[model samples]
Target chain A: MCELMALSANVPTDIRFSFSGLCPRGGVTGPHRDGFGICFYEHGGLREFKDYLPSCQSAIAEFLKSYAIRSKTILSHIRQANVGGVSLENTHPFQRELWGKVWTFAHNGQMPIEQVPQPSYYQPVGTTDSEKIFCWILSELRSAFNADVCISQVSAYLHSLCNRLNALGINNILLSDGDAIFAFCSTKLHWVARKAPFGEAQLRDCDLSIDFASVNSDDHVSVVIATEPLTKNEQWLAMKSGEGRMFVNGESSWHDFGPEIIHKKSEPTKIAS
Target chain B: MCELMALSANVPTDIRFSFSGLCPRGGVTGPHRDGFGICFYEHGGLREFKDYLPSCQSAIAEFLKSYAIRSKTILSHIRQANVGGVSLENTHPFQRELWGKVWTFAHNGQMPIEQVPQPSYYQPVGTTDSEKIFCWILSELRSAFNADVCISQVSAYLHSLCNRLNALGINNILLSDGDAIFAFCSTKLHWVARKAPFGEAQLRDCDLSIDFASVNSDDHVSVVIATEPLTKNEQWLAMKSGEGRMFVNGESSWHDFGPEIIHKKSEPTKIAS
Candidate 1:
């Protein structure tokens, strides 16, 4: 499979440090080195970079360490190439347009062809099943709502979509439209919130640590979701199988995809810290 | 050339609507179809997807329109071949591992060979100058700090590094490590913030609009930065040439590269917003 990383903050923040730790696993530390990519949402558009090359040796990865691009929501991935070929065209974090805004998507697991249908408003540029699934989701949404519908209504529709995707098997996904982020977990997924009373954080993949207190203001609040735990020191909440969560403005909203096969929900569930 | 999209918010949000508007430009509305990528920083790690084909037709892009991966910080991009070849090896939003964290980066401008030196901790996996520059930056930071530094100190050093990069030329960039976001502008960067009094937003590339207040809570706050204005109804703050800005949590800090060249200190004149 592959690895994933995401950040949702009350303020604009950079994910370079966490990415720095997770990237090694793409090839050196682990085996997810087929390709890697990242995206940052600015006000009106999106900034993204990717490499069909392994994450461990990609120069673009190195540049991010010092570039320091900050945002309220960000997504990143390192692929191991399960279903798609190890070509740039098959890289994750795909983009498409519908109803005017640019939409982005990334996946961590594979699905059977029977799970998805052909898309209407969006189409796949590559042959990856991940891309095909993304297209199917958008087409559903376009047919469901008009261009002027409220996002909340869209969010409810998406919750149902995630449920349908979860039935396809291991549907861990990350998606955005330059405004909010929606995450779903079918297999491996985890998350954490760093806010006031923040403490030190040590990387699980590298020999680095960061003290968030010094750099964060009292009003600053952030939530992170990932495929695996990146830090050894903090508490990373694992998403129960078949669980779907929506993060908006640094807060999380969750829905159960199917409790019959998935694990039970944990107590003391917090939406946004 | 390439286009970037980012969102910084007080809450977790999705960029599907905005991305829906921007993806068409990546070969449909415009010509940035060489490749496309996106990254979303979740609670712990990141989720990224990319395709070497034009985003307009990419299936993955279509899926994102309805995918509910919500986060406060989001980044997305559509590429028009510049320094890299039209292959996956040269995709944007490259990733790597350093100091135990996954680091990601994407660039909008080209860089000279002189800007990058031999790599140490990181190296380029592609032939793109963009990747070379990314690795060089990581090498510099690794050589200077062993990955155990405080976030503030790292931010300070990054500021200096960004200043140096701005001197190179058209260094508009966005970077993250799944923790915070850092942005530097050399030329053609713009941003806007939306909060409690959020209003209607009309897309510049498509005939679509959204009134954020109808979907968001009163406490919600969001900020967006882009290379060009994505909306016709909102006011965008353009970064002065040779300036750098950093966003943490939801707030922003800016610095001028090489001491304000516009007018020597003496009660600096505020440029019209």
Candidate 2:
């Protein structure tokens, strides 16, 4: 399995501190040394930085840690390469355009390539089962909606689709369309929402720490989601299997936990820290 | 008018030398400081760096100039926005996926928005006439061809559509599909192909100079295309009005100059140096 990280904020906020904690896991602290990618979405457009190199060694990844780039929504992934080769085309955080908006998706688990639906509107540029599933998901969304619809009215259908994909295999995912973020958990996922009266939080992977009370005001709210809890002191809400949630403007817009569906678990691989 | 730069090389080559010259024109030496963008194609995947900010002041652009990134094909643009706002979504070197390949297009002139065809398979995410034209071009290509066809058979139809767009207004453009670079000149464009017996060349935009003999062997060949001559010492081939050329593997594959088409030219504005 791969590691996924996502953040949503009411005001434009930087993820450098959180990203700092995750970068070490790319190779120095974890086994996911195959590749890594990240996307930042602001008012102008979405900008992506992906490298086939491990984040620990990539200069671009180092630059990102120092750039202080701020955005409203962000999605990132570090791969261990189960279904696809270690190449740029196979990098996660796959992007496409639908309804005049750029849509981005990143997945953490593998599925049966033959079981995924063939694409019509969107096609995978890489030979990965994850990318094919993303294209298939987008194609289904395009077919279901013609024009812009209220996102609140959009979650039920999405929940059903997420439930369907869960049957094939593990499906931990993070997706966004510039305006909103959608996350689905099949096995493991955790999230934390920080707002007014925020206090200090410490990273679990790195020695660095930040005091939110000193940095944030009463009006700001931010939410961060990851495959595992990223902070040590913060209370992370762990999702049950077959659970999904949507975030807009740093707040949970909708959530659902479908009836449980059974699937056999594959043997887990351990990597050195 | 804006500036365009493209490079095609038989082997992986760095464009930082040529890009250094154009960097000054982005804001310091010339006026077209609306925005700037560049794309590098390496190992069948494309990565782009664009800034809504002026290139002269953008740290990302500076990082790009310092990084010794090498690729087989590269395309870049510096915009003096005319038909679109200075936004990231409206930045040049617009990209779309067609037939599992990323197609990039950058334009230097304007066209009537109403005269542009409505898109079917592709649509513009931004409100730029240039982006609309690009989407229309991709839409047309997706409809006419379903699978891989000979490059020679494809250029004739492309020439016709470009000619049609030229009838409405100026349409100087640089386009690529990873395999090749296509350039069309409605007002001014130039190209230079360098190979064995390489000699000294000096930048027209900067005081820097390079002697190719020290860096390259006898077999290396590279083709550079720009809106105007970029070097004073090198002989540059100027493209005639309505002339178009395609480059693959550092050599010309096809070229055409259609009959003269009339479109009113607007007085050019001089940018601050």
The DockQ figures for the candidates are 0.02, 0.53
* Model 2 chain A: ten consecutive residues of lowest lDDT: A264-273
Stretches off by above 4 angstroms in model 2 are A150-153, A267-273, B150-153, B267-273
iRMSD computed for candidate 1: 16.3
Question: What is the C-alpha local distance difference test score of each model?
Answer: 0.71, 0.84
Candidate 2 is graded, for docking, as medium
How well is each residue in B150-207 modelled by candidate 2, as lDDT tens digits? 3345777787777777777788888888888888888888999999899999999889
TM-score of each: 0.50, 0.95
**A8 in model 2: Cα distance from truth in Å?**
0.8
lDDT of 1 by residue, A1-273 (tens): 788888888788878878888899989888998889888875334567677778889766776675677788788888988776786556778765445455678888765544566665455645677877888887788788876653434666776776666655556888877567778777789998888897889998889988899788878888888898889988889987656677766777545545524422232122121
* Candidate 1 residue A105 C-alpha distance from true site, Å: 0.7
Candidate 2 chain B, poorest ten consecutive residues by summed lDDT:
B264-273
